[model samples]
Target: MSAQSPIVDLPCALIGFNDLVALLHALFIKHGTSPEVAAILAHNCASAERDGAHSHGIFRIPGYLSTLASGWVNGHAVPRVTDVASGFLRVDACNGFAQPALEAARALLVDKARSAGIALLAIHNSHHFAALWPDVEPFAEEGLVALSVVNSMTCVVPHGADRPLFGTNPIAFAAPRADGPPIVFDLATSAIAHGDVQIAARNGERLPPGMGVDSLGQPTQDPRAVLEGGALLPFGGHKGSALSMMVELLAAALTGGNFSFEFNWADHPGARTPWTGQLLIVIDPSKTAGQSFAERSQELVRQMHAAGLRRLPGDRRHRTRAKSLEAGIEIDAKALQQLRELAGE
Candidate 1:
């Protein structure tokens, strides 16, 4: 852990990537997840930790385990992929986690895009509990333009509305870069992600300005209020609200999955699968921009790097990943304790 970071009574543990994955695998297996599915989820968690996204890494294990324990997610799901139309493929997640389903379709989807210029993969009845960049970064690494979107359980209020109507719908985009790693970026339409608010609450931390509103529709920076009987605020006001709506249409409507509001919170308050869907598009820029695609991309990136005033997207993540892969992952003490209990260690 960095010395600059705040220290607590309990010191965090530095766990090797291999050990972390093994721990998650054991926990998932204990929760009745098949080895293959467990590995996929483990890999996703490890990747998130490697990239310094702790919110989606070990922080999410308990929630995933609870859902699996509830028998709401099919641990052995192998996700069926089928052809829909020209350059369009559909994947049925069988009420399973999203990673395995997307992984199963990667090779075929990439090949289709390479041959057809663009390919769309619509994932239905899946639960996306991880970061979106992990889904698209690999595609970008292969010199493809990747775009992914997913909607979750509703928590964000619509623009100019007091009640919650949308999820913290997330969108991720990536473009290949010859000079460096892919230009990967992912973000939720809400001013703050629901997971982030929960994380803050877990750590007993306050939230930043304009992140959410209290139960009475009043703006507040308290994470507790934002999570309990309150709603998150859409980022950029109307713009983020519109983009959140777009995600609902693209990921939910287009993919034939449940919308955020479709979740019946009153019926099942316990942990369960997100029952969400995702849309991913991969495009071979080579087909559209011809031979100059790489050169053009390099030129723009080179200019930006030369200026030194702005940092490229994904650069920080790449740096963090390198450090993590070399040293290890720094896990919070509480999260480590939970992992130990979950693994029955």
Candidate 2:
């Protein structure tokens, strides 16, 4: 896996999203999942990759299957809304994956916003949700301003602290444009995403200085050390740590999930499950701007583009997705082989 070694090529398979979902469903079934639930989970993973989030795509199958086998996730549980008032709603996931629960909540928010002009939702007891951009992109396309936040397992250390204290909480904002893709900004509060660290480890690369620390609370470039007992650093010293703390309070405390110093670690199977939390907000543009909102948005984007910004928020992902679609997903041979073995291919 070192850089000095030749890159290994995986067998390329050209298939539609549906085909990928079918293959994933079959694999989940083999791992003892109910066919109906497997189909939904598989579709979610496939959709993630289609939207250019390879880290949360098919690679997550093995981990999910393990969670199922260990009973950390209740495959049969249906999410329930426990509170609703005015323009706010709260849901309890009941130990299920976050996607279905969040989707249901987002649907409610969108539907309610059409009438009330705004809606907010909070969810708890959920597992890892995929990329936040995909969740907000649809709302933006529908002429709504969308915002979302999610708290993960603790892997980020606060400023001037040696021990890990907060998860790499992610936040996303999206606003519609008249003539181009929606303006979207989705980022982790940490210096880098945990997925990028995992990818770097798989490729046998060293993390840049200040990205993470080792088990002994010393700076290290070895990805394994970071993955095993170390933690990622915040993005901008205190600013990032402050943002991470804010998300911890908003997502975990406000939503009744675990929070700083108490969050569960995903790497520990015997540990209490990391029942994560999420918050979403949606605002209808038509309520404020009448019919000229789209034109104003277009003009704003044109001005920004004219000022020399070469790429829009989601433009790079769109390009990567197009290339992946044309050439097939180019996973490493070792990773591909592991997936195939898991699928019993």
Candidate 3:
């Protein structure tokens, strides 16, 4: 999710990546997560902040804490992996966070991909509250092409529909290139992400037109209305809706997980994360590509630049990552203080 509230001129403080991770780890542990789970989640969240994805960064700490407190998600559940086939892997997250489950099965998944030329991992009974890019980018870093999708809670209205029936399902892809960082992109099928809506609400900002509708199915610009009893519109109408449906099929139905509408967290107060499923496909390009896969990818990028493309999908993030590495991640001072408080520092 992108940052909805601008903090560029806010009173800020710079913190090293490691320091931020330590703080987040302490905070998660304090909120009832096991040490191992805390470590994985901490690194994931901190990486978002480091890459300028503020909506899924420390901005999500409160939701994580509340969900933990409600006991809606297991803070210590271990994932059980099943090698369904030579190129297929399945994981039952035991009602835990999806990232940990992915971490648990990542090595086996990679091994299968290398050996079989392609591999698929289906993770179910899990909650995924953070950005999806982080889940697939590492595979690209390891020289594997990766694509992932996850369905969130039901908040988006399918095209030509009167009510919401689909989540802001996101698709993320990452591929290695010889000349630069991995080519990566993560995008919500909805006009906007649910997290961005929440951020807009909290920051007293109004959404742009066509983002969502109120309880009465009337167009609305107020973020609170959208969060309280409204529904988001799918991006590009039918095109995005079709992709969202595909995500539901891949991430939920195929994974033996709940569909967006099948999820009922009403009984679990403060449970904000969507307890759905995730699907990941990894490919060993070397197995099929006639030429060097990374070199081919770089060539494509060069052609795009030649065609006057100023920025690629992950340009801002890579630039931000480099800057953060050199100068530390600049965060709002108040937000940093809140993180410290959460960590009981």
Question: Per-residue CA lDDT of candidate 2, range 225-261, in tens?
Answer: 9999999999999999999988898888888776745
Q: What would you estimate as the lDDT of candidate 2? A: 0.76
Which runs in model 3 stand beyond 4 Å of their true positions? 1-10
lDDT tens per residue, model 3, 224-246: 89988899999998999999999
| TM-score (all chains, Cα) for each model | 0.93, 0.88, 0.96
Model 1: ten consecutive residues of lowest lDDT: 1-10
In candidate 2, how many Å is residue 182 off? 1.8
lDDT per residue (tens digit) for residues 225-255 in model 1:
9888999989999999999999999999999
Ranking by lDDT: 3, 1, 2
lDDT of each: 0.85, 0.76, 0.93
